[model samples]
Each structure stands twice: as C-alpha cells, then as structure tokens.
Target: MSEHPIPDAPQRRTPGDEFVQALARGLEVITSFDAEHATMTLSDVSKRTGLSRATCRRLLLTLVELGYVRTDGKAFTLTPQVLKLGTAYLAGLGLPQVAHPHLEKLSAALGESTSCAVLDGTDIVYVARCSTRRLMTVGITVGTRFPAHATSMGRVLLAAERDLALPETLPALTAHTVTDPDVLRAELVQVREQGYAVVTQELELGLRSIAVPVRTSDGKIPAAINVSLPMNSPLDPLDRLDQVQATARAIAEDLDHLH
Candidate 1:
C-alpha cells in the first residue's frame, strides 16, 4: 500500500482572518436592522449593507433561526432576545459593574441624574443610569437613545473622535439645538481641548448636563459619563459642572486601573 502524504499543519488564527471576517459581516447584518429600519426586506438589507440580496437573506435567516431575529411574511426585524448579547457584554464589563455604586452615591449626593453611555453610531445609548427623581416630562430610561450632537455625553464622546467630523446640518431636535455644522464643529474642537462638555437645554427644555470621557487603562476614551440636572434647580450651574467633570474623571481613572 502506498504511504499517505503527511497532512499540512493548520494555520494559527490571527486578529484578521476569514472566520473573523465572516463573523463581523454577520454581526454587521444583524446590527444594520434598528428601531427605524426594524422590518426590512432583503433588498433593503442589501442596500443598507451593500451586500448582495442572497448574502443578506442567508444571514437574516440564520439570525432568525438563532432567535436573534424574527421575520413575518416579507419583513425581518430583530427580536427582544437579541438584547441578551449586549446584556452579556455589559455584565462582563467590570467598569460599569464597579462604577454603579459610585454613580448612585453621586446622584444621591447631588440630587441629580447620572448615566454612563457609549457612542453608537451618531447616537449615545445609556448603558447605566442613576436617576434621583422623576423630574422630566420626557422619560429617560436605561437603553434610551439620544442624538450625540445635541447632548453633553455625545459631545464628550464626539470630542474624542479623532479629527472630529461634525455634519454641516444636524437633525434639529429642538429650536435651541445647533443645526449649523461649522458652529458645531467649532464647539466640538473646544470640547476636545477642554476635556469635557456642557450643554444647557439643548436636548430638552429645563435639562442641563455635563459630561467627560471615560478613558481606558491605555488612555483610550471608549465612552462618557454624565450628570444631568434640572435647569431651574437651585444648584449653582458652574459649580455643578465643575463637580460633575471632576467626578467623571475620577470614575474614569478608577475604570482605567480596573481595566
């Protein structure tokens, strides 16, 4: 009998490889469907991701089978079960877990609301929040999404965006919201230099807030923490801003050490 040829050694996995590439593509497809585009057709998914119709359909069907997505006749949307993926990540993040008690203490002391948020595209989604009281008419709960260009948390995160690109025309959430791109870009530059952001009544009337970037152990900013107060509250606005920024920096330092 002829001797069998020796099998080649398997290649070691690198950061960039076909397996990672395909997984990334699948994740992109899943994330592409959001609240606004919840029920998208295969053509819509393809258009949004620049993927072929067949590829989009295959991934969508796979996700549906995995219970991360659901389809009804002709439309596909993410299922509530999809949140488990993000929930697992948040649970694993030591910073959020460690910072929660501190954040609660700060909110109780200041009689204001505090939140931790990470940039998600052009929006900031609150991952953790400690609310002092139900003060605002427009309810803000954890996981709520807000425009990054109009909020202190968003600006702080945007300030860290290298060579920060600010759009010329931001969607106007309120009459006081900045719509001019140049002005917004200038503001972002100032925020980057100052290392924090303050916005007064931009998102909602009577709402004021300050935010600072949370840096990793490597000094890389991945998110922001913010304190929000009512505009009419007796708290000295300038003093509150200073304190919030200080607290955020302290928390960020703690996070750096933990990470």
Candidate 2:
C-alpha cells in the first residue's frame, strides 16, 4: 500500500448479459486492501471498495471462509492464501522465469536494483525484481506497485501505451514530481522519441531511476525494466541507459523465443 488512498475500482466497459457484478464487487473488496489499508474495518472496506456495508460484509465473509481473508471480530486483513491469486497470474505469464536471470545480471553489473513491471490501470505492478539493497522506505519486491505518473518505468509504459489517458492533475509524490498533465505528457513524448525515461527524486525523496520499454518480436510493448539508485549517486543514470536498454532488449528477445 502507498501513502495515497486507493482510487475506486474501475467500472466495466460493457458489462453485458453474462457479466457477474457480484464477482466483480467481490474482487474489488479483495483489491481494496493494500499495505496502507492492510487492516480495515467493515466500514473502511465498504468506503474503499464503494460497496454497500451489506455487500462488503458478505464478500468479506466469503473471502474469510475461502481462507483469503482473516478477521479478528472487528478488523479484516488479507491472509497468505490471497497470494495464490497473484501467483497464478505470474505463473501464467512466466515473466519472472524469463526475466529474473537477466535482471540479476543487470543488477550485478550496475550494482543497483533492477525490476520488470507492466502497466495496470494507472499504476505499474512489479513482476520480477533483483534488489541489491533496500533503497526506498518501502521494500521493492515482486508484486510491488507504484503510481504511473511519478516513476521512470511508469513513464516508459505510459509512453508506449499512448491511448491510456493521463490524469489532468497528477498527484505530487515528492517536490520534484511532475504534476501538470501537459508537462508530463511532453516528457512522455520525449521518452517515446528517445526510447527510455529517467526519473529523479519523484517517487521518493532519495530515489532516482531509469527505465526502457521491453517489446516482443511482433512489436507489442508488454513491459518495462528499470534500475533504481540513490538520488545523489555519483553515476549519472543517462551514462548507463545503454546497459539498461540492452538488458531490456535481451529480455524481449527471450520472451520472443518463448512465444
């Protein structure tokens, strides 16, 4: 979870005849829990998921019975069993299996943390990572997520997915974060032209990162890779962009072979 509040779940584009609203609402209830809201009361969940108290209770109780959530009579928290859902998703993609070795090599070469992530809604979700040390206040690992507008990898993904609308006024994660949509859009255009992005002290005060997009052989931009370092590090992120780009290309090549 982040310091920012979770946004409401997105509505379906065209929930047609076979659409199951109950299942969708149930998933929303489960996703409402994050690191910041790890332990939420029934009212808290209802508010976060935008579900009625009755609906929230029923879904929470169902999750609890299914071993996905646990309750202490008053508050609720996700259980380890919930990891199964994320695990199934990752296993289906086989992304970690394909990228972990390359990320490890890249991290070893750069002596920095390297990660692979995909855009989901307005955020980036880490699918694979190789960390050299703890850099941010929160631990960066598989399944970690960050707002798209304020991160290097997020910018790369957003630049690649041009049709996804950028919010008019993005949240300022730090003093250096780009909040104006037009300014951010221009930066993304530059990123698109240059084929990479570098973010400095945006997501956090002491963090800087550089990222490149990873594309498949058929020309699909599926994910992005990044290397994170201290904001005041001696090495310039641009000086090492070539290496990061090479790693991204290698990962993409491997993924192409997989397909």
lDDT of 2 at 50: 73
Residue-pair clashes per prediction, in order, are 0, 1
Q: Would you list the C-alpha lDDT of every candidate in the order shown?
A: 0.76, 0.89
Question: Compared with the true structure, what per-residue lDDT tens digits does model 2 show for residues 1-259?
Answer: 2544666655555788999988888888988888778899999998898778999999999999999999999999999998998899899887888999999999999899999999898889999999899888788778888889899999999998768687778988888999999998899999999999999999998888999999888988889999999967787999999999899899999998888
Q: How does model 1 score by TM-score?
A: 0.70
Cα-based TM-score, every candidate? 0.70, 0.91
| Model 2 weakest 10-residue run by lDDT | 1-10
Model 2 ranges with Cα > 4 A deviation: 1-4, 8-16
Checking candidate 2 for backbone clashes, the offending pairs are 1-35
